[model samples]
Target: MIYITGDTHGPKSIGFNSVDGVLHRFNSNNFPEQKNMTKNDYVIILGDFGCIWNVDNESSSEKNVLDWLDDKSFTTLFIDGNHENFDRLYNYPEKQWHNGKVHEIRNSVLHLMRGYVFNIDNKNIFAFGGASSHDIKDGILHPKNDLKLIKRWKHDYTKQFRILNYTYWELELPTKYEMDRGINSLKCNDFDVDFILSHSPSSSTIDILGNNNYKHDILTDYLENIKNTTKYKYWFCGHMHINKKISDKEIILYEQIIRIN
Candidate 1:
């Protein structure tokens, strides 16, 4: 079995400081209760691995996130998100913890992109990633509002799978720029995703964070049109920090599944 979740700003962010505690809660309550969990289980953390990759100093809260999952044997998979400093995450110096486990290890041996696929529990899942392009001026990716990241993908040909957008600037910058690529990927390449996991909610599952009136309506119409024509399964997203259900095929929280017919 595979578990999917995203939009954790990290342990040090001022507004989203309790993320570690929430991860612990989810791990303790949700991980143990699952009947399908096993040594072979894979956990897919969509993005936002850390709030700021520049903080070389370790915070106890960040350590707590590692400590909470120390004993887990599952193969954890991670991809980069916009909030995360991509270069820092990819090149951060490694250290050892008192427990003898390597600290601050980035699990991304693979680069995240639009058509990559991984097999978990006998099922094939594909991931497409897009974070705001790194700002050379400010050296930060999140809190950036320039509807200009739309040109990242040159082509989109995902074989029926899931869409996980890990960009944190969703509300302030709904990545309206990314929409054309997303829709074009689906339409031009004849690709259809069974599920989508975006860090910020788009078009209504639960986007109360931004109250994104403009993009949500656009996304809604697009997704609805796709659902009407195809046998698409579900669209699962997080970032609103609230659990919401938009329809039979869309959910606005973490850990939801859709069985393709």
Candidate 2:
């Protein structure tokens, strides 16, 4: 079996809320648990890997998270979240904090801003890391689980931002790579993305949920239009922190499948 989960923010130190410290509800232990598994199982983490960019610390959190899903020792896939720093997403440090304990100072995951494709068990899946370049003006933690937060984050027009530079990080795929890799295939008239998991949902999927009085972002409209006309199977995203489904002529938005092979 395969398991997919999201939005876990944890710190490593034995501070308050630590495994032996305070009692917490959303600690690293929240990762999915399974039994009767095999080496073929898979696990997908949508985004929001942690609260800060502490790579060494984050590794500990990840270790604990992985422990919960250890029944079959599934293969793991990670999507970079806005809260995560790109530096640690690609290059893990080679230092050790203690004997036999390694401090991983980087995140080992595919970080695609525009999008990417993956081949798994003879099935192809596409994804886009929708990490926002803007600051988290709304604070990292929210008390409300209401969809209102989702809507606010989606339509927070005031926070509109773009990629300016990323010279310090190797974790993310270059912007050029993200833009250049797909046009040809999308325009090929035959190739269609199987699954697209992005950190930020395209404005078409997210904005369309809003009242139609507002104008759409031109690029968003263009991409969605192309995907619809091109014929893709599905789109999965995490930025809004809301699980939703949108049906279009080209794709089924946010549908879950147990197996694709």
lDDT of 2 by residue, 8-74 (tens): 4343424554432101322335432434434565555555545335544455545554453232345
lDDT, candidate 1, 8-94, per-residue tens: 556433444254322643464546633445546656555555533444544577556655554455544444454654444545544
Model 2 misplaced regions, further than 4 Å: 11-33, 55-72, 93-115, 133-174, 182-189, 211-226, 248-261
Residue 249's C-alpha lDDT in candidate 1? Answer: 63
* TM-score (C-alpha, index-matched) for candidate 2: 0.56
**Model 1: colliding residue pairs:** none
The numbered model that scores best in TM-score is 2
As for model 2, its CA RMSD to the true structure in angstroms is 10.5
* Deviation in Å, model 1, residue 75 alpha carbon: 2.5
Question: Candidate 1: where are CA atoms >4 Å away?
Answer: 11-23, 26-30, 34-36, 56-64, 67-70, 79-81, 90-117, 129-190, 203-231, 254-261
Candidate 1 contains a number of clashing pairs equal to 0
Q: lDDT of each prediction vs. the true structure?
A: 0.44, 0.44
Worst 10 residues of 1 by lDDT: 159-168
